[model samples]
Target chain A: MTLAAASHGFLSPTGVEIAFVLVGIATLGAALQTVTSRQLVHAALWLVVALGGVAVEYLLLTAEFIAWVQVLIYVGSVVVLLLFGLMLTKAPIGPSPDADSGNRWAALTVAGASAAALVWVVVDAFRATWIDLDGTVQGSAEVSGRSLFRFWVLPFEALSVLLLAALVGAIVLSRRGGDAKGAAETSAPAAGEERH
Target chain B: MHLAYPAVLAVLLFCTGLYGVLARRNAILVLMSVELMLNAVNLNLVAFDVWLRDALHGGQALTLFTIAVAAAEIGIGLAIVLLVYRNRGSSDIDRLRDLAERPAGPAGAAGSREAQPDTGAEATA
Candidate 1:
């Protein structure tokens, strides 16, 4: 019964596929806005929308655990971190000219070419492939947890260590300039004195 | 759902990120674009995992790992950008061309005229 529908060509669209397309369009639109907006802060805000749309796509794909994580980590924390970075850099409050670099046309050409090539290859490769969502849930939190602990325990532990290293590195990199400033303040002039 | 939908969506999103990375002047915006690219890959992973239904669920697990790594990357990236901003007074990539071969000097008009002949001499040689 289901096998016949699985073989149905492009004309037969399913409910989930329709929803996925809608959300995907919204997500791509937000992503475009994020990149092109002149207002710096607005770009960050648009990023939140794009990330949230990706989360919804995850939900449509039935990966419940990943969807929530995407919400919590990307839309929640990463966007906030980006906002903080923007403010710390003293980015302009409103639109200022020169938001894009001079090489954008070149970039556009390259990106467009790659996108064309990649989309052609991907669509040609997977034209008839259909994902069957009828069986037992694949991405429930319980299933992901069991698999993480059982088959993926080693890499999971290693990731924790990498997180720790990054935490310490961020702190050290952020705080590094203060001590060097005073020493450089004294030695810089001394070195100039020697040079002259 | 047909696999081509997610695959094509991911391709488009990745290209958008690639454009952002190339075209954006601000470091933070570039980081946002990188996040977009990574999320596109995550969507691909989740979609294929569901399709394959791996007994070990490698696709979904890798997605979790990717999310974590992305979080760490954003943290470290922001820190570095902040440090660069403090040192350079602006986070604009175009202005931070210390390593460029162009010899634009501090003394505006006279400097470039002097530099032009030297570069021209070098170029011809």
Candidate 2:
């Protein structure tokens, strides 16, 4: 059986419609909270719901590997790390005065335009294409892993290096400005001349 | 009607995420919103993957890469946000305006501006 049937076997179209609506509602609720929740941590929690809904939708569509990976990487690691950073930085964790301000209008304008553009592109491109639900195999982890290390190897390695550079940059930036021994030692000659 | 499901979900997810990215000041919350947007894209990819399972598994492979890149993004993004918060005592994107337009300024306002592209849809949220 295809992953689609595995997800919901023998369901009436109405049943699928009901499930879709329910999931949509849940997804929207979490998304709203992600934006509107005053607490930073609460926003992250809401993101979990939104991400989880996507995973479920993937499963329903027979893309099991993508679904599980979404759970693992996005829900498990990414959000947890975000929360970790939030705590480490000592963010207000509550209502912040700067959270919403005069820029709301500007932000809304930009966001709306981008969304409209994206939706337009997607809809326009696919307007004539019909969804073929023929039970063909797709989304196997083995196949995807091979492609990653094969044809896409260069971009993959580039991403790794980029991440490494970002890690080092973060460490350098986090150090106190005046305390770097390298900078202090280099400036010692100038200090001596000034004293003379 | 069936095709509309994925399209509608994509639009909603994208809009909600856009709102979060714009309205939420906390760096972590902004990251979560980005994840929402990525998830929206993933849905599109998988839908296409299923629809066109012949020749080249394009969508599934792209989703895999997207996941990897997202991981790296979170790692780097969190570290930078932490550093900024430590130095400035806040993660509010608005406050980061201090870095605006400074030549050779710390990975500055462009980052905030890049994260703020959803101004119009954000109001409906």
Clash numbers, per candidate: 0, 12
Docking class of 2: acceptable
Give a tens-digit lDDT track for model 2, residues B11-71.
Answer: 8788878877777667777788888888888888888777766456678878877888888
For candidate 1, give the lDDT of residue A20.
95
Each candidate's DockQ score against the native complex?
0.46, 0.30
Chain A TM-score by candidate, in order: 0.90, 0.68
Which lDDT tens digits does candidate 2 get at residues A1-196? 2434334422445555567677878887888788877776777788888889888877767677888999998889987888788778776756766656566777778777877887787776655444445455466677667666767778768877877886776667655443563465364434322322
Which candidate number would show the highest DockQ if scored against the true structure? Answer: 1
Among the numbered candidates, top lDDT falls to: 1
* Global Cα lDDT for candidate 2: 0.71
- i-RMSD of all predictions: 4.7, 6.4
Clashing pairs in 1: none
